[model samples]
Target: MVNELYRKQLYFPFSHESRLEMLVEKERKRLLKQRIIMHIDMDYFYAQVEERDNPKLKDRPVIVGADPKKGMGRGVVSTCNYLARERGVKSGMPISRAYRLCPEPECVYLRPRIDYYTRESEILMQIIVEETKAMVERPKFEQVSIDELYIDVSSLRSYKRAKELAKLIKRKIKEKRKLTCSIGIGPNKLIAKIASDYQKPDGLTVVKPNDVDRFLVPLDVDALYGVGPKTKMRLNALGIKTVGDLRRFSLDFLKQNFGKFGEDLYLMAKGIDLREVVEGFEIKSIGKQHTFEYDTRDLVEIRKVLLAEAKAIDKELNDFGLAYRTVTITVRFEDFETHTKSKTFALPQTGWSTLLEVGWDLFKEFYYASKKRIRLVGLRASRLVELSQLKVLKNETRRF
Candidate 1:
């Protein structure tokens, strides 16, 4: 009888515009219902792990990366604790600068131990899986990185239950690992990710479907996913400094100015993201970058850096049992302008020689096109294929 009544209502001879409005409203309601995604980020992961191992380093500023050769090291900072941040040290800053900011007896500087960190990550992942199983019968999980992940618990269909699960996971991680994590729960992945980063170490923020706009509007435009420094500058030029400002522009105007990405910005301004959490991870590419201690116009020196990066990448590809069909080189000029050039072969290639040859060839383009001194260089091997899937292998005997 309820089905018959609903069917009659659907054919009630409503005006075309009214019918369209009703259909749109129905679709919106369906899309907004019962989606529960949670994002978890281990707080200050690398530095936090170092602090955990040495309780004495607990409150002191800890930096985990290359040694600062007394304000002269060439390497970059990997990660630092909040204390270091307060002292103006940040990840990716030059180690020399970090030394100047938080020098000597005041700071606890340590090198990164990839092996030990991997073990700790494995333990944390096990705890995550175990606790997830204990809470939700079946949950979709996606590990974004070693220190970040997403869990979809739509089956529970209750924000209260999801919050309880988040608390439980947090407790379990702290109890077993003596570490803390921040969690964000929202109706979709985009909102969840932003919420997770809303607060710092050991934070929990939840944004319901109805509250997404309110949570997002007051934030800066750059806080939206994929809005990098360059994009933010462009948006700022147009007076779109905040998400609320971005919302005032018409969809057509945005599309006219920004093309395909403009449509994405428009939807993001309204807090609409339809992506789902899928299990498993894929390596899209592998690459390494090096920043020069001083900018230089020397092509030979740049080529040497490219060769070293290629050797490192070759080792990684072999370790993964993969081969690549494309080589890309990234160049950042002294003025901070960055550009990338790529080359794709007819078939996959192995070993470092191909990367060096192709990379140097690509670099000459920018080297000739500009008089700008290069501040950094990078090399990437992409369009990867498994060695087991290939019928031919080239230069397999040669090692970089």
Candidate 2:
């Protein structure tokens, strides 16, 4: 009996389930030691809002943007539901083409309701801030155009805490907004942002720091943030397709070819991003532009478009709580040649009326050449400082 007991203890001390449980416990503890970041992305945000308001639009292919005009309209798609995307439609694609793809398409081509969306965004942001103990950060430095957000959940180190917070945020957003959001959890902001996109339309993905390599290795190099079309073509020409292929090249080699952006690409491909989530971010500049399907030299049309563009910029500045000290006008000729002319003001200003007056004045002075057909018009505001930080400039300082 003593010999049999000794053999049992030596050969099968733990059951299979018990061993698996031990492995899971070890992994969970290991993950808890690292900084946990989360990225929350609303699924088809604009379309979802439209759907929520109108129940008849549910489960249907909803396209939000400019009117297709039966495959002859100008402008680009802003957002589309999953059902529309499955039919070979995507954001930024020509609205005309979107109409061509969808069978009996339910297209809603209307101007974006800036005020309504702003209110919704504020409500969702408030919910995130109030519920979670995590440090919330936004991509407002570039533009408040991101439909997604980066949150630092490092305070919630334990897996249990992180999971609970994620669940709560998701539930609250859905309950309050009647919309779905996908969330990604990772060790840093970059990984979390990428992970959130891995699964879409209501996905929740978590990637431990140690597991980042396993997941990122197979993704395309272009999948990394900031790798635009030009960069993607360049990387593809060099036989660098996947993130794994990019990893083969040294950081020095990448920098030599692509300059500073190349170095950033190399680090990002290796899943190494250390960007911090900053709070109370502000915009540096505000601008608006439109591409015309047909080039024309009509001054009346040009002035109309410029006024509308100025109003859009004004709206954006107001949303960001910023004021501009300079106004710029850009014109593109039919041949795709572009030139910009700008004027600086002594006082900070952002009202739509003021911006339009400045824009019209600049256009009249700089746009005397009637020989060339105009293809595009743009308005820009710069030299921005937050309204709260404004300081009056003295008369001597305003001479410039």
Candidate 3:
């Protein structure tokens, strides 16, 4: 009867073997608590790419984005070199504002070359993996973005070797790609990510387990990940300006005020992040959106904007070597009312054609249903799966 009860508790589709595998995986991940995590962040990625391609642009301010047409351009800056940053130019700043800050002959403005940048990113990632593969049995790596990644070298069991590996990766990238990256080593992802930015351009910082508190305490609470402007203001109101100050509050008190996020804040203040370094790249969604200078009811203009966004997202999907099973379209009216519609496919799709076809249909449904002028248009692809993983799954299914 006990055996029957236990067997009945097991859910359908999860065999006894699979259940045992899940338990084994969970135990393995829990053992990673003592992991040695290393984070790599390329310095001024897009702008540096431009500078590398043109030696003459070195030491000069280079801004890569929409043409900053003498303080009258519409789009925002994609990225700017350290020199442009010194002149108060920032990524995501309006091109008009970027021009105002670092105007004319002083700064070189150029549009983004997405394809070239993607190619460079792929080559750099390959170099990192190939250079470090032989050092340990299997160092788990995760690419967070085109220019940022994390590697788990817990198998090495030495911070000294971790730092050495970081230097080797950095040197190899600079040698082969003419690029520089900053690296940070710590006991977990949160500490490593923050340490990566502790120093600029070419930097390597290591914070051992015993030094986690010292490395985190004196810093402002805003230095903790996920503490944005609003959260900082709330923390400041509670007289918690620094991580040291935050340690004075009780975890229960924090949870009472901020709910689930408060627990994260409390843990961060203690420099305690138990999250493991998940291997491989995993993206929930990729999207692009644009707000028009003026709201209009022109379908031709709307389709053009959607098409451009679809093309950009398609390139991103291709760059990541992934495909999507869902397409979603978002439309915001002039009065700030927004609506979204989505379609999911039985099979994953690649290329912009799918987006344009499904997105246009979804938008027209809304356009005809409502009598409001459109202010913004957006396209998003979700339910992403790596193309290689899909092929493997297909092969396994065929064996059945």
For candidate 3, write residues 1-400 as lDDT tens digits. 1233236546536766455334433433453357899999999999999998999999899999987778877668999999999999888877888999999898899999988898899999999999779686689989988899999889989999999999999999999999999999988898999899989789999988777778989999998989988899999999999999998776568878888888778667766676777888779899999878778899989999999999999998999998999999999886777899999987688889999899999999989998999978899999998988878767776898
- Clashing residue pairs in candidate 2 (N, C-alpha, C atoms within 3 angstroms): none
RMSD in angstroms, candidate 2? 12.7
Per-residue lDDT for 1-400 in model 2, tens only?
1122334444445864344334434443454346777788889888888889888888888888877777877667888888889989999877778888873446555556667887887788778767774433322211134466776767656545666777888999989888888988887677888888898878888888768888889998878989888789999999999899998876557878998887677667767665666554345688998877688777788888988998888887877778889999888776667788888987787588888888878776656755777777888999986766555453445676
What TM-score quantifies how close candidate 1 is to the native fold?
A: 0.84
- The most accurate candidate by TM-score is 1
Relative to the true structure, candidate 2 reaches a TM of 0.75
| Tens digits of per-residue lDDT for model 1, 287-354 | 98988877999878898899899999999999999899999999989777889999998778889999
- Candidate 1 Cα errors over 4 Å, as ranges: 1-29, 292-301, 334-337, 344-351, 371-373, 385-400
Better of 1 and 2 by TM-score: 1
Model 1 pairs whose backbones collide: none
lDDT of each: 0.86, 0.74, 0.86
- Candidate 3 total steric clashes: 0
- What's the lDDT for candidate 2? 0.74
